[model samples]
Structure formats: C-alpha cells, structure tokens
Target: MLQLEGLTRRFGANTAVDGVSLSVPAGQMVGVIGRSGAGKSTLLRMVNRLTEPSSGRVIHDGTEVTALRGQELRDWRTDCAMIFQQFNLVQRLDVLTNVLVGRLNHRRGFGATLGTLFKRFSAAERAMALSALARFDLAEQALQRADTLSGGQQQRVAIARALMQQPKLILADEPIASLDPRNAQVVMEALRDVNRRDGITVLCNLHHLETARHYCDRIVAMQKGRVMFDGTPAALTAARIRDIYGVSEDEFDTAPEMTAPALTPAREAALPA
Candidate 1:
C-alpha cells in the first residue's frame, strides 16, 4: 500500500500541494481529476519524489519514501515509473533502444555502463525490450525512430519503455491530454490493461471527467491542492463534479452518447466496458 500523510509542497509564498493525505491499496487504478492549477501534477510529482515535499511523509509498503537518497532513491524511481503528458523520448533513437533504457537500474559495473552508453544490449535483454513493445502492439515499429511515429504511437512506445522497468507503480501525469480522442482511448485502455493484467498500481492525472469515470477504478478529486473527493467512479456523480469543479453538468459530462455530437475520435471510445 501507498500512504501519504499530510504531504505538502510550497513555492515560496504559494502552496502547490496542501496538507493532503491518501492511502492507495495495491493494484488499484486511481484517477486524480481537477481543473488546471488544482495541484494534481504537484501531488503526483511528490509521490514520485520528482518534487520534494515541503513537509509530511510518503510511505510505500512500510518504507519512508521521503527519506530515500542516492542509490536508494534511484531504486525507488525504478520501482515507480512515470509517464508524462509529453512522451519523453529520445527523438533520434529507435523505439527498441528507448525501451531498453528502462533496464538501466539493473545494470552495474563500468562495462555495463559503457554498454548502455553505446546502446548495446545483450540478446536476452533485447528480447525483453521487444516483449514490452509487443504488449502495446509497437513491436513492428521497433526499428522506427520515436519521432517518426504518430502521437499515439509515440505514447505507446513510452508505455512500453515504462513496462521494461517492471515497475510496481505507474504515475501518469496527464498522459493523454495531448492526444486525439481515439488515441486517448487507446492509451487509456492500454493503461487499464497494465493495471489489471500485470497488477501494477496506476495513479493517473486526468483532465476529462468522462475519461476518468471511464477508465479509473476510483476517482480522487482535487481542488486548490487538497483532495475534495475520493470514491468509486459510480459515486462521482454529476452534482459532485459540479461542486468540485464549479462547472455545470453539461461541461463536465463526457458520456458516450452525450458527448458524441459527431463521430469524432474523442467520442469513439468515450466509455469502454
């Protein structure tokens, strides 16, 4: 389990993440939803240790994650992978090499470091990286440059790279915010598959209420750096969304039929069973 006890982060006079506390059980896909600047990204960053907390503690399975440093912190990062809004890839590198980067944590010794610097992978390691890409149907594009693929394809490559880390937890910060609707659905479904099939915990920051309701097992609503609501997707009703985001039902509702004014990609997989 992951526990956040009064986790907080401040930017001088402004607090980005307030005294927020949360406990996440294993193998759960939790979506953090809110308007822009609600501190959702800051909260996820703190959990990943990318953003140091101003105060409070983050404990994961009995370890004080906040106290880890050096190699310990690097190990923690390997165990907890992060996927970003922008698919952070080496544009010039082939998809396979990028995926193999996930294995950096497992390498040691100067020889291993030199091998990684030159992008040289042993046969077994190459197979492992290939397998990760296969999960997202990107194995066929293994030799392709990451920048050459479409936005959705690049994101899939990013996901494949994360899978190679063999992480226990995935922190996706607005993963699909930049994708087209069909691509968004594809990425979301891929994430859901990872959560269920591999039993990896996923904490995704989402912008669309319908997207959150469609893909997450639980919804965590944040407002001004604090958690405003936490419950099953079924419990996050339209009225509750209105109360949290200060928007009317229509603006927040992303139901398939309700949102599909035309056959746009955004509506293609608005809801998935």
Candidate 2:
C-alpha cells in the first residue's frame, strides 16, 4: 500500500535517512529497527510526510505522497494515521472524545458540531467509539478523563483513535518505549490484532531487536541514515545485527528482538480452503 523509493533526508551535513527504499503492502506489518541516530525514526517520519524529504518519493496507493502540501498533504495524512511514543491526547478530555477527534477530518457540519464540544455522540458513532476502547478493554474508562488513565491505557486510546480513522496505514514510532513489559505487550498485542483483522498496513520503528523479530513480517535495519539490511527474521543473525549496530555482544545484557508490527504470513495457493 506504501512505497518509498530512494528516500533521503538530511539535516545540515548529516543525512538522517539515505536513499532507503522499501514497500509495505496492504495488510502487512513491517518493523524498522536500528540504534540511536540510525535513521529509523527519520525514515518513518518521512513516509507520513511529517518530515519533508530532501529527495525521493513516498508513494501511497498510486499517488506520490512526497512534495505534497496543503489539502493534498492533509488528505494523505488522514488516510495514514501516525501513533507516537507519547500518547499526545488532551489530558483533560474524556477518553471517548479524545478518540472522536480522529473523525475531525471526515466529519462535517452537524455531526462535527455534536462532537467538537461537550455534545453527545450519536448512537452509531458512540457505539463505534466505545467499541474501539473495548478493543483494548478500556470501555469502562471511556467516560473518565484521560489523565486518570494509566500510560498503557492512554496509548491504547490513541490506537483506538487511529482505528476510528479506518486508516489504510499505521505508523507507530517507539510506541512501547514509555511502558513496562506487561503494558508494552498489551499495546503491541492490540496493534497485532488490528493489523490481522482489519488488514491495515503498519510500519513501526523500534529499538529492540527480539521484539521486531517476533512481530514483523519483514525487518528493515538502518544505520547512519541508510538501510543496511532488509530480510526475514531468520536472516537477521547475531553477526548481522552486530554489523548494523556496530556493537559487541558484551555491550548489552538482554538480546531481545524488537518485534514490532507485521510478521509476514506464509503464501497459500488460491485452491480450495
């Protein structure tokens, strides 16, 4: 659903993403893993047009998403929602309303009016919003203010908001960085469920390797603003990772793979199921 060709981004003399090209198909989840300043985040940001590319094109569906601005850019971003490391929700707003903000671009006139203020949502929209919260088992807390919810719950709410958009692609940048192991698992599992059932394309940038290995259909490794490796989890051996990170085995304790979004599904022939 998304394609990046020869994508490059530079800040002064330092290139953050260097000529990286990759494809994320519809319903696929791909993980981006790299060390600090390795350009993983830069690559993801460029895909959504949040960071303008110095060169190259980001193609979504068929349109060239790069170099688009104003209404064109806004419309492109609407179809491809971005979830961040920070929840970025309005702390004082109710969880339900926070998610309703996803519809801001699509909703019009009267229906938009009902949600902009303290106005109550319609039966259908409310149900859909509540269903999103329940996907992360936070429906009970929908009426509660966002500040009262835990960090994990808040991130889940953010994901629900993205889901409410019915986006074609989801970009998550270190989404689990702020959570504990248990909570991180919760959020990641929620993402997996969304990708599986809804067929939404996902590209997540993560620091951990083991985590990516487990969750991603394909792993794209970056180093010094360029793609160093792109392959299956099995192909990313210890030696390969060392080459990408330039770190020795003794540099860290745990060797957890940064399993993020989609693990590739095995191809099946279209015969009889």
Q: Estimated TM-score per prediction? A: 0.91, 0.88
- Indicate the residue-level lDDT of 138 in model 1: 89
Give the per-residue lDDT of model 2 (tens digit) for 201-223.
99988877778888888888877
What is model 1's C-alpha RMSD? 8.5
Model 1 misplaced regions, further than 4 Å? 250-273
lDDT of each: 0.87, 0.81
| Residue-level lDDT tens digits of model 1 in 1-273 | 999999997765567679999999999999998777778887998897987788999999999999999999999999999999999999999999989998899887899989898988889999999988898888899999888999999888888889888999999999998999999999999999999999999999998888998999999988778899999999998888777766765665343212112222243234221
Q: Give the TM-score of candidate 2.
A: 0.88
The residue ranges of model 2 lying beyond 4 angstroms of the native Cα positions read 109-115, 118-120, 248-273
lDDT of 1 at 105: 90
